[model samples]
Target chain A: MAVASAVAYRPPRLARKRTRQAVLVWCFLAPSLAIFLLYRIIPLLWNVVLSFADWAPLRTIRWAGLDQYEEMLHDDVFWEALWNTLLFIASAPVGIVIALGLALLVSSEIRGRDVYRTIIFISYPLMTVAVAIIWRWLFDERVGLINYVARSLHLVDRPIQFLNSFVWALPSVIVANIWQMLGFYMIILLTGLQNIPPNLYEAAAIDGANARRRFWRITLPLLKPSLFLCIVIGMLNSFTSFDLVYVMTGGGPGRATELLVTYIYKLGFSQTRFDYAAAVTIVFFALLVAIAWMANRLSGGNAGAVETD
Target chain B: MHRYPRWPIHLVLVGVSFLMLIPFYWVLKTSVTGENIFAYPPSILPKSPHPFYYVDVWYYIPFARYFANSVAVSMIAVIANVVLNAMAGYALTRDFPAKAFVLLLFLSCMMVPFQATIIPAYLITGRLGLLDSYLGLALPQFSTIVCIFVFKASFDAVPRSLIDAARIDGLAEWRIVWKVMLPLAKGAIATNVILAFIWSWNNFLWPLIVTRSADMQTLPLGLARFLSYQEDTTGALYAFCIMVLAPGILLFLLAQKEFIRGLTSGATKG
Candidate 1:
């Protein structure tokens, strides 16, 4: 009986070691798994559940089953918000072009390229709200720098209300958005520029390719991955355009600057119509996911950082 | 390309840099000037620098409280992020049957945009009875998926021989992780801490919704409130923007290299 007990107690050494490793793995994984499950995974599932139920008034609690979505279909504000979001995405190419220009300038045989890189990238690191406020001050009709400069330079006869007018509001926001983001785009493109072999450019020179031709043929094609990266990032940043619009215009002078995210925030928090808000959230998320999926497919999966946005 | 002088490129770069600094200059100029902001031909320099607005901001609004709230939230998030991400990251690099699945889960979670999760997350905070608390605000940002990948990459670069040697020397797994693995991951850790701090400190949406009381507001919330509350107090508004923006800008300037590395390297790797 004693010998049998000793044999049982001294389990296989390899098996015991394996068990210890498994325990260690679990120990390491538990915290991250718990946090992600509670904060991210569970909430994502619950968002879908919340979308179908009417919990706005507790006494009228019941599953609506697409009623909220139906409400969105009739809501003009919803369509306006969707259109505005698309416009925001459309405005990204402007920033990307400016960024590419800046990247090219710095990547050349510039004397102060490093200094230019640092200075140009400064705004990306600052608080979004702060950056927005600076632009807001600059947009001030009475004493704004932009208006002052424009008026003095005889460019415009009058002080334009950049954020107040419906026509100018969206474009104004886009310009500010582009300025803050140019540095990020420039740096990423700069990395891509560095990776291109100097020999290719030199060989192109030997083939009598002029600067403009070289840019169109060699530089542009070789910079595809970086260009794709900028496009995706620009799209992502534009759609998530809350902090800037929130500070600069608060989604208007009207619904001019209203974005999908801001509209959802207003519906849920301000109006307390959470049921309707959840439905909007679901639809908006689906659109963004679809865009991401399409982008991934079109890029042939070579462009990584699908969610760095 | 060598046929032309590089001075033209240098000139263009300088011109752009100056354009970039213009807004920052205006903010500084406006915040300091005591003169009417609406004055035609706005002065580039402050007429008489209103240094008092900086001090008066604390009394005008609960600036100190909001600053404290930001610091507390950021620090808590950073600590939680470091520990949880390191454990998960280290374990991920080691031999494990469920490794691929765990990583796939992490990557999937990474793709979950904040806008999508925020609505249900708000409800979750309410259910947990943490809606009005600091923990509720910081909880979502406690550990990021990106930071975990950062640590995993960092650990993968650390030779496996060290871990085996530590095990052979009778070092406990916890000790090996704490002493051996962590010290080597200083760069990644620093990157995560700074990024977490900036994200939490600059966070507006979650803080705006979760905190019901006036005093619980973070810097961004407080600044937004301050901006709207006194419509004509342009100096005060600019002053507040400067105050709110200074710390983040200063931190980035001081650690520019680390930030650029973290921003570019971790981003590309993930």
Candidate 2:
């Protein structure tokens, strides 16, 4: 209806051209629309339907009608996973601060800045599985370098047991996650930093402003849109994080690290409770929607001012 | 002499960069180190740099096959996405009925997580007899929402006058998009191509689920198999890590410009 109303008031000569354009547009959109609907959208709707029924892959789906949702409301594990997901999101500010700090440091007229940027960004392309695998080895109890170094420096009495311990496992994973994500965000934030006209800083210096004051007043406001974008994407990505947890801890140590997405996987695949998993997934989807909507409302969803890759 | 002496800043930047590069260094060091990786005071540099670990990984594991499979799958998937998304992006942005409906459809696809469809996708693949095959891997990614979004943004950037002029000529719609639009959008196309390739190459979960046989595994799945070997051969594990990382890292190095450009393209809108 919006598009129809949009095209309704065109001139006659433009009308024929517009019709042709319309046909061309559909021809372009068909394949992608088909695939997205089939693989992504339909499955989402199917998951919603499955949530209301006792759907299992091997057995006939029986309508449960909000029983799963009700169960989720009472489940302690559900609450735990929710809190962990929030914890993970909370962890992202560390990465943001690190990224912004690096971007600020490297964005200056430092010699070899390009080399530094390239080396830092190099890890972004390495497969996440390889990173997780190697990091796991590094976090190993007996042989891991982190514990060895810490012990050597008299930082701890014994090995830290990074992954095995319930208390340390999530934080350890969070550190690795931040490491992997920092380069990408730094590069992103650097671009925004560089976009600020150099003249502004020069003028500020001429007016006797200190570096700290210049950064706080001039740089921070100009970089708000990018910072806001980074926050939203970082939060969303952390909330739905699965690969790191799957590869590192497998949500082990008695489900201490089980995120909502990971929980959805366990319930559906491991427990064979598809309907319940579907309900969980539906709620998870709602959470994502709510978060994105909240961010948009906060920022006014101005694609021109703030967007994320 | 001290006009531009920000040496301390440089020192700090280099320090952080070294911190960034440590993991890659460890990967290289561990792959070549002798059988003492688990020893205390880990070797800063391997005393005896053994190159045979690479050869051993190829011989002892099906890594060669996995590498080839990854290359094939990533290439096919990237190509399919590039072509399909270019068309879809052009249509949705430039012309067509129900334009708002189409755009909303694309946007909503981004909202749906793949975890919801993993089982159904497996069932579909099974029904289509696509299990443990290349099609099962490549087909799903071809309809990627991210690529469509990228291409649509690029197509939107194309000047309206040029498109109108082409239409004024005797050019067909397909010819206009193919000849006129695509040729003008090489930078964006290259950006999407590299991104799509990197993503497809790194994908582990789908391949792990779909492929049943060892021979059909991609590099990620192959590395997982290598890690699960229980051999405790640290050198071999490092060698496997290097193999898994080498291609993606090398590609990233080569396409660093595009990688950064593509990543920041959306970011700067803020």
TM-scores of the candidates, chain A only: 0.90, 0.89
Candidate 2 per-residue lDDT over residues A169-273, each given as its tens digit:
999888888888888878878988988998998899889998889989999888876777677778766876677788788887778888988888778667878
lDDT (tens digit, per residue) of candidate 1 on A162-274: 98999999888988999899998998888778878889989999999999999999898878777777887788888787899999999998899999999999998899888
Q: Please write out the lDDT profile of model 2 over residues B1-270, one tens digit for every residue.
A: 126579888888879887888877776887887445658777676777879888888777877798899999998899998899788767656544567676676666766667657756666677779889998888788877666667777778889999889978978878888898898889778988998898899887789778898878999888777777643455877888887888788888898998787778767662
Clash number for each model: 0, 5
For this target, which candidate reaches the highest DockQ against the unseen true structure?
Answer: 1
Ten-residue segment with the worst summed lDDT in candidate 1 chain A? A300-309
TM-score of each: 0.94, 0.91
DockQ of 2: 0.57
Q: What is the lDDT of residue B77 in candidate 1?
A: 85
Error of 2 at B142 (Å): 1.0
- At residue B225, candidate 1 shows an lDDT of 85
Regions of candidate 2 where Cα sits further than 4 Å from its true position: A1-18, A206-208, A300-309, B1-5, B123-129, B231-233
